[model samples]
Target: MSKAKKSEFRPNDYVVYPAHGVGQIVSIEKQEVAGFELELFVISFEKDKMTLRVPTNRATEIGMRGLSSPDVVSQAMKTLKGKAKVKRAMWSRRAQEYEQKINSGDLIAIAEVVRDLHRSDDQREQSYSERQLYEAALERLTREMAAVAGGDEITAAKQLDEVLLSRAA
Candidate 1:
């Protein structure tokens, strides 16, 4: 058997993982595992105190991707303001589908989840699970957008909301 070639990853790089949102690459490390050496990219998410080690070469295959471009993030923000598409399906089924999209690490897909699940101030109440998923998607999308725009998450989120609101009106 042959060892796989390691792809180069740098510190301060923004990356997205399926379940976790955007994270910054802290370091690249080589460690011995079962008498073999493995190279890993250390990624950290401050919001969760979670660290992930992904094999350099396996990053893309596992849906790990760099921060989306500013244009891409802007497009996703526009998506948020678009008309909501609430399915007639059961809540459980819809929630599962939304979770899958979030974990896919696709900004547009995550934005779709956020848009469809978002409730306006005057809207009816959202179920606990719905609220949780909505917040998660919003956070994930905003973090990446902020990184791309060279701004903080709060600013990015507010910008996104502004775009959406303007589109809605």
Candidate 2:
């Protein structure tokens, strides 16, 4: 690898880790490991109360990405307003797919999960697992939305609720 280090992210930048949703890059750290210098990004997930250290060289390789752009956010919101698509696959298979989508860290994919799994008041009740998946997806979607809009999760959630409720009508 060339000694030229071109980093696209800096401290305090919000980024999404595929498996961990959104986290802020608190700092960039350089440590010596096995007689070699390694650079890492120190990320903090406030909502999950977790911190992660990922090698800077592996950020993009591991699907760590910056927050969604405004257009992407709008596209995700449009996805929420669309009809839900629940396949006829078995529940277990569908559950696994939903989990995969949640962890993919793709805003639109997460939005689809939230839209499909959402159960309005009059809709049939959801099972325990279903509710868990929905909440997980919702949380991921909400966090990214909030980060993009520079608002709190609660406000983002309310905006999402309005969109979903309008879709149901």
Clashing pairs in 1: none
Give me candidate 1's TM-score against the actual structure.
0.91
Give per-residue CA lDDT, model 2, range 1-169, as digits (tens).
4343537889999999999999999999999999999999999999889999999998988889999999999999999999899899999999999999999999999999999998889999899999999999999999999999999999999999999999999
Per-model TM values vs. the true structure: 0.91, 0.95
RMSD of each: 3.2, 2.5
**Which pairs of residues collide in model 2?**
none
Please report the TM-score between candidate 2 and the true structure.
Answer: 0.95
Predictions in order: lDDT = 0.85, 0.93
